[model samples]
Target: MPWEAWPEGGFPRFSEGEREARREKLAALMAENRVDRLVVYGTWGSGDAVHWLSGWPVSREAAAVWAPGEAAKLFVQYRNHVPTARRAVAPEVEVAWGGPWTAEAVGGELLRRGGSGQRVGVVGPLPAPAWNHLAAEVREVVDLTAGYTRLRLVKSPEEVAWLRKGAALTDRAVRGLEANLRPGVSEFELVDAIERAYVPYGGMTHIHYLSVTSPSAPDRCVPSQFPSPRRVRPGDVVTCELSAAYWGYPGQVLRTFVVGTELPTEVRELHRVVEDAFHAAIRALRPGLRAEELGHALEVVRRSGFALCDDLVHGFGGGYLPPVLGAEGFWTLAHASLELQPGMALVVQPNVVTPDERFGVQTGELVVLDHGGPEFVHRYPRGLRLVG
Candidate 1:
């Protein structure tokens, strides 16, 4: 089933006080930058900032304009959604039609809010046309992307609660996948089973990737992005890297399993290497740790004669946020070196790639850093599961 078929309430929301706190944070940054007004943008699929400030998501295109001293005015596409948006937002937020042309609509709203003499700040992904239009009407345009990333890196109490819930839903999905694991079942069937697992809890979408290989040809089989007609077989190594979202927040988890009996010796060794990297990086995931230090922990895999496929770790909020740990080449400089702090949520993915690019393993989990140490949000067994 499609995620749209699921109930709208599948995702929980932050309290009104939480939403106000976010606005105040942005407003403070605007003041520090000498920006007289702030314009936050959101699109159909990427509406984190708009949702952060207004407590309503933009299914199409939307913008929220804040003038520092007054309530924020939200402009969304389609007047029909105004009623729904109004119901989602706090009383202090004003919901209105941003018109089909978001750039023009937001531009006009900015002029009315602060006129042409005030400096304006932009955050999130704003269309170039809308950006140009707004630029013509403001005294100066400042990019608040970095400021927004810094602010969002640390989760509030409310955000942590939501993330925890998201993690629970993810755990349920993985269990559902495990329960349905057996020979003769097609990969697509397993995919459906995972998606169905979320509908009951109100999960919006199950973004996932699953692939399978025989023990003898672990390096020979190529994984499919989407499920194929091929059915599961005994001794096949099934690997999945999946995530499910609740109220726009998502938690990712990964697993590799043998369809029956034990894993091949080579596969077991690969998993061992990946697990070492996962543990080494997580041990450094504490309040005072630097982002680069956490990344350097992944160097263990290279020392073990294995390479990483992609990113090692990232800050997770409405979506992937700043201070990405792994980037460029795994051998090169790390992405960014920001300080780790309590209340930070992250996805620890230590994927191992063989030099031949055929055999690999992914062992990852959703984790939150507290003052004490790192806590696992989703804790499924780290080793390879044997499914019959």
Candidate 2:
């Protein structure tokens, strides 16, 4: 599919073939592990597995049981959610209410499906109570979260198509927030602007973190996970890490903005270093590039006498897959030996802060790893934006 050919005004729907492909891959994984039944669990905060497998973005709590040649059964909590959950899943899936206790209901259903002597593979964040119940019923329960993450590492063409729409919506939100940047606007109002830009087009806000501070007497270094009531002031620096989603896929973009035309020398220098480090990672991105090799980009920040207040790189779009790295000596690295592959989405944000950790700037966005190099998902203009 062409990158920009998705429908304009509603949620993008995956084709039946797409759903079948995912099911096939998952079934193969279960067979390789010698599992007779697979239990996929999800909740409001963490539902990537349920969403990917059944097309339903989980609301409160949900679980599914799948075995070879048998139709998958999806159990959802809160009776009111059953209708929408039924509408969202495939026609073959059986959707039902889990009564008072969702975990116990799933456990009872599993036992009826001949789970007593079978090996079961589990995915998603199943609570301890639920895990204990399933373990007692089944012969053995295998944690398949790692294997599930690997399955999502490489997205399908349809997933990429949806990601493109997500990135476009994210760009719209950031630009909307940029246009509202001026003295006297509260951080909450800024978040309102961001949501207004995309919600009308069915976009959802995954995160809209903002950091407001005066460049001359900067107090905050990184974007706050929650927005404050603090109002913007003349000559203040507004740095943000925003993400807007289309369904479950989201695009992340980090940027720094100055509230006035006069850019502080230190802030300018800091952004320059950030841009350099961002592009350095871009130039080094390729299909076979090692995760640790991307650390070369951090060298630019370290050499410039600045350190990072946030992660420099991470796998994104499909549940923060792997290769979460930070500046050397600043944060611990993970998946250091993982290799980059085509179709993987990643964010290369380099939030460069002073050695004192009092001032910083944000820059970077989501990119897809290609054979040639990293393909930027967002079209938001790079560099320090000036407003007011």
Candidate 3:
């Protein structure tokens, strides 16, 4: 197969088990919600619903509808609007290339094929303009809220294996980049070091979020730059929030490194406390755990001493993440009593940041929940590094 050829091994080249898993989950939701037919719709960044049904990933916009007794139909956005939609969607999509349509029309097009008023379930964020369109057409829409989300919470064994590759790459990115970092390097230089180390290892830009911090201010990871402008001095720290990807699957890792020389006394203590909290969170993972139970584990860090800016951990994959993690629409069961199950991918980095105080403290790793406990995707490092 070429670099872009797909459907190899009976699964989409980018996602193994994603299509069948999504279909089964959506069908189950339709049955549970009494939806005779469901319009699992989306556009651009809202591709979650579409990806949740078909193996196709919509870069710009796309839609899919599933009927109880029929195959799902997919629709890609028009050419003038999104070129990538055409490339990303499978060529055999049941429905594609509509002349023009609102978000609701995207749904309506699929509904038309499936039959209207069929007790439809909607799975996308509908804009006001499109809401009117869907409202006038499909009167009944069960939110399908937890129905689909809960289904996505747990990963399959295959997803875990793929995520592990990403995690390994992220670990390499962190370790390799730090070895190249130095006192005179700018943020951009450091970013270059990270990605130069990272890109060859794994990915497309999907999970490339990273941050750099100085040891004097150890808590956070900021975006990268060219020249990085701000030079690292002796005793400075570089904190990284880097993730690697095998296709679009992500494995997040956060690690701190010292530049020039040794870390300060307070920074070392802060790192220790944060690492303690992080491992404690890992220990707390299991099939019957609550999402918010991590807050308690974070407190263990807070007590050991450090002010955490908030949020201990979050869900991962396909834009599904906590609001604290820069996600626009993830249903952060982060604070709820939601049960943690095996096979879920998680990025837990309990960072302690001070809005007014100097120097932050944190470290984190991606882990897959296993039957016995959480299995780390990213290799755990024993200590921070001192580059040059």
Tell me, by TM-score, which candidate is best.
2
lDDT of 2 by residue, 1-388 (tens): 2223335533356898998898998998898899988999998878489888877778889999988788889999889999888877777789999889888888888899985898899999999988998899889999988888888887888888788888988998999899999999999999999988887776877888998999889899999988889999999999999888888789989999999879899998999999999989888889988788887888899899999988888888767668888765323343787888999999989999999999899899999887788888899998889887
Worst 10 residues of 2 by lDDT: 1-10
TM-score: model 3 vs. ground truth? 0.82
- The candidate, 1 or 2, that scores higher on TM-score is 2
Give the TM-score of each candidate. Answer: 0.90, 0.94, 0.82
Task: Please identify which of the two predictions, 2 or 3, would achieve the higher TM-score against the true structure.
Answer: 2
In model 2, which regions exceed 4 Å deviation?
1-11, 328-334
Local distance difference test scores for all models: 0.77, 0.86, 0.62
Each prediction's total of clashing residue pairs, residues at least 3 apart in sequence or on different chains, is 1, 0, 15
Model 2, CA-based lDDT: 0.86
Q: Sorted on TM-score, highest at the top, how do the candidates line up?
A: 2, 1, 3
The full ranking of all candidates by lDDT, starting with the best, is 2, 1, 3
Task: Please identify which of the two predictions, 2 or 3, would achieve the higher lDDT against the true structure.
Answer: 2
